[model samples]
Target chain A: AQTVTQSQPEMSVQEAETVTLSCTYDTSESDYYLFWYKQPPSRQMILVIRQEAYKQQNATENRFSVNFQKAAKSFSLKISDSQLGDAAMYFCAYRANRDDKIIFGKGTRLHILP
Target chain B: DTAVSQTPKYLVTQMGNDKSIKCEQNLGHDTMYWYKQDSKKFLKIMFSYNNKELIINETVPNRFSPKSPDKAHLNLHINSLELGDSAVYFCASSHSPGLAPDTDTQYFGPGTRLTVL
Candidate 1:
């Protein structure tokens, strides 16, 4: 079974600064997808960024980027030029090519200091 | 337009009561899923349907049932609900199956907050 783990339960960063939320997963499959989702107080789950296991270039979406290290099974999300809107409960997720369910980590609460 | 939506944004009921949450997607997606977010905020998949066919059914209790009448709708019915069942239920939809690339993004609904007293 594949399991996603977010080591940091809570993270705080000042506005205009940068913060990284660490995540790791245990999986045997080499071909899979990793995702970072943000759930704000509205409880809407929004996709921040995603990375394919076969791609080594990593994935960047605006101020959000993922540092995906396949061999290390580590996928961390970096929020650059952080804003107050970046505050939310961030979740790290994993999905194998053959699996239908997406396994999610415990989640890390991000707090932006204005 | 609302890509994905769920009805009864908030639900409050007593134990042993039966309740239902409806989900619909207009994204023309072939796959739909139901997830539960517990009090501790752990999101877990309960069921998934693809093209109106049952695809993934997690190890959820038998009291919970998922009905998909069409490719765009997936409804969840909980029978004899218990206090433990009090949690926020989410509906999501995707365009392709699990193996397809560029289709892994699942759009979520506003979520139905169910509180079993």
Candidate 2:
């Protein structure tokens, strides 16, 4: 069984600054996928970014990027130039290449301070 | 158009009542899933269907039944809902059954917040 862990229960970042959310997972599979999903107060789940285990390079989408360290089983999300809209409950997820279920971690609520 | 949509964004019902939540995907994905987010914001998979066939059924209560009339729709019917069932349910779809890098990328719908009072 694969389990994702998000250590931070809540985080606060000043607007226009950067913040990083830590995530770690335990999985026996060598090849898998990692993802970060954000859920705002509207309750809409939006995919922020994703990374493939086979790729050593991390995944980046606009202001969101991931530090995917496969060896350490760490996949952290970095939000550059955080905006008020970025404040949300962010979840880190893991899925095996051949599996249909995605395991998610307890989300970290991000607060943007002006 | 919404890639994936769930009906009744907010469901408020009395305990012991039965209710159903509907989900549909317009992305033509072959696989659809149901997830429950508890009050603590922990998300867990409840059920999954691939092309109208039941694929993944987690350790959810039998009261929570999922029906799929077609590959594009998956509806959840809960019987005798309890206070513990008050959570946000999310519907998601993905083009899966393959090992493509993008195959398992799921598109989620605006969740349905179920409140059992």
Candidate 3:
């Protein structure tokens, strides 16, 4: 079984600033995937970014990026130039390669301050 | 166009009542999944189907049933809903397993909020 952990329950960032959400997982599998999802007030789950465990290079999607340390079992999400829309409940997820299921961590509520 | 969609964005019903939430994906993906987000915002996979075949069934209560009529549609039916069942349900889809590169990314739908009174 795999488990994802988000140590922070809540986080706040000033608009236009940057914020990093920490995530760690327990998995013995060599091939897997890590993902960060955002659920806004609308309750819609949106994919922020993903990182492949086999790849050492981090994944960056526009203002969103990840710091993936495979050996440390850590995958953190970084939001640059944080916008009001970035305020949401962020969840860290883990999935084994070719596995149909994904395990999610308890979300971290992100607050954007003006 | 919406890649994934769920019907009845909001559902409110009395306890012991039966309800179903429908999900559809137009992404042409072969795998679909149902996830439950409890009040604490912890999301967990409940069931997964690939091409209408059951792939994964978590240790969820038997009252919670998932049905996939085709590769693009997966629906959830809850019997005798309980207060604890009041939570958000999200549907997602992805490509076939082991395809790597692109198969791992799952696209989610706008969750259906189920409120049991």
Candidate 4:
């Protein structure tokens, strides 16, 4: 069984600043995928970024990037120049390379302060 | 056009009533999934279908049944819904399971909020 853990229940960052959300997962598979999904008040689950286990280089999309440390099983999301629209509940997910199921974490609610 | 869409974005019904939520994907993906998001914001997979074939079925109650008429549509029918069943249900799709980079990358729907009163 695999599990993803998001330590922070809630986070706050000022507009134009940066913030990082921590995520860790336990899995026995060597090759897998990690993802960060954001759900705003509108209740839409949007994919932010994704990282492949075999790739040493992290994944970056616009203002969102991930610090994927395979050895430590840590995948953290970094939001640069956070905007008010970035305020949402972010969830970390994990899926095996050959599996169809995706495991998700509890999620961390991000708040953007003016 | 929406990549993945769910009908009846909001469903409000009384307990013991039966309801169904429909999901369709236009991405032409071979695999589709159903997930439940609880009040605490915990998302969990409930069912999965590959090309209209049942594949992954979690430990969800039997009252919750999923039917895939085709590769592009998956509908969930719940019987005698309870208060605990009130949550946001999400429909997602992705390519078939494989080693491809986009194999397991899921595209989610807007989600249907079900309220049981």
Candidate 5:
């Protein structure tokens, strides 16, 4: 079974600054996908960024980018120029190509400091 | 146009009762999934279906059942609900390429909040 772990339970970033949330996973499969999802107070889950294990290039979605270390099993999310709208709970997830089931972390509460 | 939606955004029921949550997706995807988000905000996959056929069934209790009449809809019915069952249920869908296993993004619904009193 694959499991995702996010070390930080809470993270805060000053406005216009950068923040990084750490995530690690345990999986024996070589082909998989890592994702970061954001859920606001409305409880709507939004996809932030996704990284494919086969691709060495890290995924970048505008201000959101990821530092994926395949060897270390680390997939951290970095948010640059953080704004107030970025305040939400973020989750790290892992899914195998052959399996549709996704393993998600407990999630990290993000606070944007004005 | 709404892509995926779940009815009864919030539900409160007493213990040992039965309830159902309806979900529908208009993305034309062939696969649908049911997930539960606990109070601590831990999201876990409970079940998934492909064209109204059971694809994946997790270690969830038998009290919880999922029924899919078609590829576009998946409804969850919980019997004798318990306090521990109080959580938010999310419906998602995905479709893969023909004859190959490819990574497809899963679109999630707004989620239904179920509270067991």
Candidate 6:
């Protein structure tokens, strides 16, 4: 069973600044995937980015990027140039290769300050 | 063009009631999944189906059931729903199990907000 952990309950960042949300997972599988999802007040689940375990390079999507450390099992999301739209409850998720289940972390509430 | 969509964006019902949420995807994906986001914002996978075949059924209660009649549609049916069943349910879709570099990102639907009173 794979478990994702987001130690931070909440984080705040000034607009245009950068913020890093920590995430780590417990998985014995060698091949897997990691993802970051954002849920706003609308209750819509939005995909921020994803990283493949076999790939050494991290994944980047516009202002969002990940620091993926396969050995340490760390997959942290970095939100650069944070904006009001980026303020949402972010979740970390993990899925084993070819497996359908995607386990999510507790969550981290993100606040963007003007 | 929405790749994934779920009907009944909001559902409010009493306890012990029965309800269903329907999901559809136009991405030509073969896999669909059901996820529950509780009040605390903890998202968990409850069920998954691949081409109408049950792939993953987590430790969810028996009252919660998932139905996949075809490749592009998956529905969730809850019988005798309880207060704990109140949560935002999200449906997602991805391409086949293993294809290409596995470019499927699992596009998600807007989600259905279920409130059990």
Task: For each candidate in turn, give its C-alpha RMSD to the true structure in angstroms.
Answer: 1.2, 1.1, 1.2, 1.0, 1.5, 1.4
lDDT of each: 0.92, 0.94, 0.93, 0.95, 0.93, 0.90
In terms of DockQ, the best-performing candidate is 4
Candidate 2, clashing residue pairs? none
Task: Show model 4 residue runs off by greater than 4 Å.
Answer: none
TM-score of each: 0.97, 0.97, 0.96, 0.98, 0.97, 0.95
Could you give candidate 3's per-residue lDDT for residues B18-104 as a string of tens digits?
A: 999999999899999999988888888999999899999999999999998889999999999999999999999999976645798
- Candidate 5 error regions (>4 Å): B97-102
Off by over 4 Å in 2: B99-101
Cα deviation at A81, candidate 1, in Å, is 0.6
lDDT of 6 by residue, B1-117 (tens): 988999999999999999999999998888899988888888888888888999889899999889998999999999999988989999998876566455446778999999999
> Fraction of true inter-chain Cα contacts (below 8 Å) kept per model?
0.59, 0.89, 0.92, 0.95, 0.59, 0.81
Q: Would you list the clashing residue pairs of candidate 5? A: none
Which candidate leads in lDDT? 4
Which digits, one per residue and each the tens of the lDDT, describe model 5 over residues A3-92?
899999999999999999999999999988999999999999988988889999999999999999999999999999999999999999
Q: Please give me the DockQ of candidate 3 compared with the native complex.
A: 0.86
Chain B TM-scores per candidate, in order, are 0.95, 0.96, 0.96, 0.96, 0.94, 0.95
Question: Over the full model, what C-alpha lDDT does candidate 5 score relative to the true structure?
Answer: 0.93
lDDT for residue B94 in candidate 2, whole number 0-100: 95
Cα RMSD for predicted model 2:
1.1
lDDT tens per residue, model 4, A1-114: 899999999999999999999999999999899999999999899999999899999999999999999999999999999999999999999999878999999999999999
How would you encode candidate 3's per-residue C-alpha lDDT over A12-110 as one tens digit per residue? 999999999999999989999899999999888888998888888999999999999988899999999999999999999998985878889998999
True contacts kept of 4: 0.95
**lDDT for A79 (candidate 3):** 98
